[model samples]
Target: MIRLDVSRIKNVPGETLRLDLNFPMDPVQSQHGQVSFNSPLRLTGFLTNEGGKLKLTGCLEGEARIACGRCLDLFDLPLKAEMDEVYCSECREGQGPGGEWVLFRGDVLDVTAEVAKAVLSALPMKLLCREDCRGLCQRCGTNLNREACRCSTDDVDPRMEVLRKLLKDGN
Candidate 1:
């Protein structure tokens, strides 16, 4: 878990703290799929105490392994994300710096959940091995990028059969 010791910073406003560390994280499962980090993630950033609120700004750098959305092949994906979060010492439930806030009663602030969220948000909507990946042939389940398949490419949807017949009859 990534945590920041803010016992000193809480009493001193305008104070800044520097952070640079590497830590291992568990795989994150989402609606899309599972994502696992290749190695320890490097976190670099600073935290500043502005009045009674603590503002954390940092960058997370790492590599993640994910399955390709098109070809179903597992590949390495580079991860780099910038994060900015705010914590309040006396914030009530559902109140925060920008409509969302973390409440802390002690000097230590755990940021594991926040970091995980940042990683999730940084993921691409569609993971591809390459920009122009041809993907697999739907009919024959063949990798089109490697070679051509024997499946006929002229197959039409059942819903379009009526329209196709009308056009063929010149109607």
Candidate 2:
């Protein structure tokens, strides 16, 4: 469903095209979220040919909901990614095999995986709603950012009792 047409530029070497593609993510991609998001994904990009090989360059813009690493809050984050890669008919499993320039042979090229790769690579290692988010309290499971809890604050090192008593007496 995400195929691109290229038969028109068979003989032309320097010819290029500006394509607007709408990519829908498979159901499997929704597993990344805490909740299910059964929405279709939209991605936009361009394809061009320079020298002998064809190149795919584009940007993906969308929104996805991910759980915050600290407060466990579910928030929507705007996703934007830019990528430039050469298209090859025969792809090697590993790098260093030397990528062979693929001649534009077919009428269409499926750019779904290419777009997916770009989006996946741009994901953050740790998702967060904001930088200064106060996480949930360990004792009462209260969101510290929202309100202060009545949980005991006596959980301190016994070695510092002398200092605690000194501070308590206003010494």
Candidate 3:
């Protein structure tokens, strides 16, 4: 649980507090897959007390262990996620713990789940081992990065049979 004590600036209206937290984090599941944090995650930002609502604006920096989409190899990926979250201590009459505004009580604010969600959403769509990663062979199931495959490139689509026959006769 990532909890930050905001007792110093709780009652003070329009007070802005700077927060910097560095700690080791466990693996978390994202939309693509599970991402492991081998290095300490750095969360640095400022919290502004707007009336009774606290606005958190910060950036999370960490390194994640991601699998390559092409070759399926695990590699270290440096990640940075921007966070702009809001937590209300004194909520509105109709507002509860669901929606854009998150309801919190007391001095300590637990932002573990929120941080994980932000990092997951900021992940890249494609995870590649390298820029010029040679993927496995489709026919022989051989990894092209390690060695060349002996699969023939003469395979033709059935629809191109007429074209092949025309080429043979024209030649």
Candidate 4:
């Protein structure tokens, strides 16, 4: 967990704290797929004490192994995310248009949940091994990129048979 001690900068408005850290993360499993980080996530940025509130801005960089949505292959996915958050001394529950505002309960600001949230949000909705990934065949479950499937590709849907017949008859 990443914790920032805000005891000194609590009341200082213009005081800034610079940070550069590497944190190890556990494997995360979601409905989409499983993601595993082989190395520590590198974070670099600064935090400013804006009166009693804290403003944090940083960049997170890391690599994760994710399953491709189309091909179902495990491949390395590069992770890069920018974070800008506000920590108010008072309790605030909603996100702002620019960023998010969270409540800081005590002198310590634990950013573990924020980091995980950022990384998870940065993940792609559809993971592809390549831009032109051919993916698996629907009929035979063949890897189309590596080899050709013998299944007929020209078969039309039964629902469109009436239209097909009309077109064939030039009607």
Residues 92-171 of candidate 3 have per-residue lDDT tens digits of: 64574456777789999988888898779778887877877776665677777788867634566766756755653442
Winner by lDDT between candidate 4 and candidate 3: 3
Judge candidate 4 at residue 58 and give its lDDT: 96
| Alpha carbon lDDT of each predicted model | 0.81, 0.63, 0.81, 0.80
Q: Give the TM-score of candidate 3.
A: 0.79
**What pairs collide in candidate 3?**
none
- Backbone clashes for every candidate come to 0, 0, 0, 0
Q: Write the per-residue lDDT of candidate 2 for residues 56-115, one digit (tens) a residue.
A: 777877776677777778787777788677765434434323653333346777766666
Order of candidate numbers by TM-score, starting with the best: 1, 3, 4, 2
Worst lDDT run of 10 residues, candidate 2, spans: 27-36
Q: Highest lDDT: which candidate?
A: 1
* Per-residue C-alpha lDDT of model 4 across residues 76-143, encoded as one tens digit per residue: 88999898888988745774544467877878898887887778888987788887777776668888
Candidate 1 structure quality by residue, lDDT tens digits, 1-171: 877788878879999889897988888886569988779988899988988788889999899888888777778889999989888888887875456877778889888888888888889887887777767776688887788886633676766766654653441
lDDT of 3: 0.81
Model 4 score (lDDT): 0.80
Query: Cα-based RMSD of the predictions, in order?
Result: 6.1, 7.0, 6.7, 6.4
| Candidate 3 wrongly placed segments (more than 4 Å) | 92-98, 152-171
TM-score of each: 0.79, 0.65, 0.79, 0.73
Name the Cα RMSD for model 2. 7.0
Best-first order by lDDT: 1, 3, 4, 2
